[model samples]
Target: MKLLKVSGILLLSSSLLFGCATMDKSTSTDKVKETKNTASEALKGVTDEYRKYAIGEIEDFVKATEAFTTAVKNGELVKAKELYGPARMYYERAEPIAEVFGDLDPKIDAREGDVPEAEWTGYHRIEKGLWMENTTKGYEQFAEQLMKDVNLLRAKVETVEVTPDILITGAVDLLNEVSTSKVTGEEDRYSHTDLYDFAANVQGAEKIYHLLNPALKKKDKELSNEIQTRFDEVYRLLNQQKNGNGYKLYTELTEAQVKELSQAVDALAEPLSQIGIVTEAS
Candidate 1:
């Protein structure tokens, strides 16, 4: 049997740290320990192969995002088009790692505005936003304009030997999710239905973490802490009251709340935008 394990940086019961605030549950201290140990048993040695791909995928994504950013900033519409495809590809590659929990997009696909009446695949949202904006004005020309910048970053991700610590960060994310099953089904607030996806992300994180932590544990405590802190920050930001909940706030949100919601979306979007950040990063 292929045993599954949950992954990193998660606290409380939920599918991933972000998204519409999950309905809450009651997982006690003892249950938490039991879950962790079960995951410890399941995830043995799984991180090795997954780590290599995850890091490479992350670096490549970063490069593609860099290219796209440069093109956008330089107003090279042609280069932007070129960057968009590969940047998107890299994002797609890393997705297996990031979207470990619940339905990745979970956007209500009810017959409605904006969402086209077509079957959709997995949701990689930041890309969706960028693609929408880029297509509106530049079309494929935008990608073409980003050629030089794209080429430059592409070379970098190809060569960067990722530190193991980064891998561990990903793994820990999974452990947190898998650790939940030990808590009893009814007690999980996000519902048992979504738990698999939640478990997936957690498992992805856990695998990466396991591969990298041994090499990192003695040397890079700060980096480890930084990842944990970021995870906490992400959860806090996601948990704050936001408008996207049920779309009921469409008319109710004030301009400031609108801005707050916008900012929250962007902040919640950070991990999703890592490749974009790499593209945009100096």
Candidate 2:
């Protein structure tokens, strides 16, 4: 019973870490071809040893995260405290990648309530305020959600189904999503508090390029244009992000621009998140 009550890892950096799982489904368009060619291509470029190195590190982090989240959820306040450091290390390991891409590190800072806007970018100042006031509880709601999410994926990952019909151009959009989602602090800065999302995003995006770039050349000009168009759209939204303002960065964002930004982020989020950092048992 205590296990059920335990909370999540409370990692703001890994905030959107599991959010991208929804990307596993297919896009409506017929132009997308499902292919593992990218992964195969990547295999040649990267040694299996390297894959294990990256993938193993992430798995270890997730396990520690699971323990911490469970303790928090159980309200075993004592147990939860003990797990914080190990849990925090998971985030720390992946920080460099996340920051390089422009993500807000929970280890570094995030916005919370009552925290002055000026002190906004510092370590979850507003988060403490929110918890104190019980306004926006940090990952209070998300703790257990990902446990089920990961359990489901664990089984699926062992024998992941791949097809040649749905080729993702690459997972860069996913990395871009985690990194740039920081434009607005509201998307769950604390969620991505650690570097897990950043690592997964980078790992996943590289496969996209590694797998699809060759097939892209065989595509007709129109198909290439469409792919280019979609890719560019994602790029523009990522680039458009304010230092950390997101939509708020706009002096006066029209409803249209807001919608575009949302759509842009969503468009690339799936591929990167779904298959970004898959691992097979050695």
Using lDDT as the measure, which candidate wins?
2
Global local distance difference test of model 2: 0.40
lDDT for each residue of candidate 2 in 154-192, tens digit (9 for 90 to 100)? 333333222221123224444454446533434334333
Q: Could you say which candidate leads in TM-score?
A: 2
Candidate 1 segments exceeding 4 Å error: 1-43, 100-282
lDDT of 1 by residue, 53-93 (tens): 76576566556566666665566655654444334444333
lDDT of model 2 at position 210: 45
Model 1, residue 72: C-alpha shift (Å): 1.5
TM-score of 1: 0.28
| TM-score for each model | 0.28, 0.34
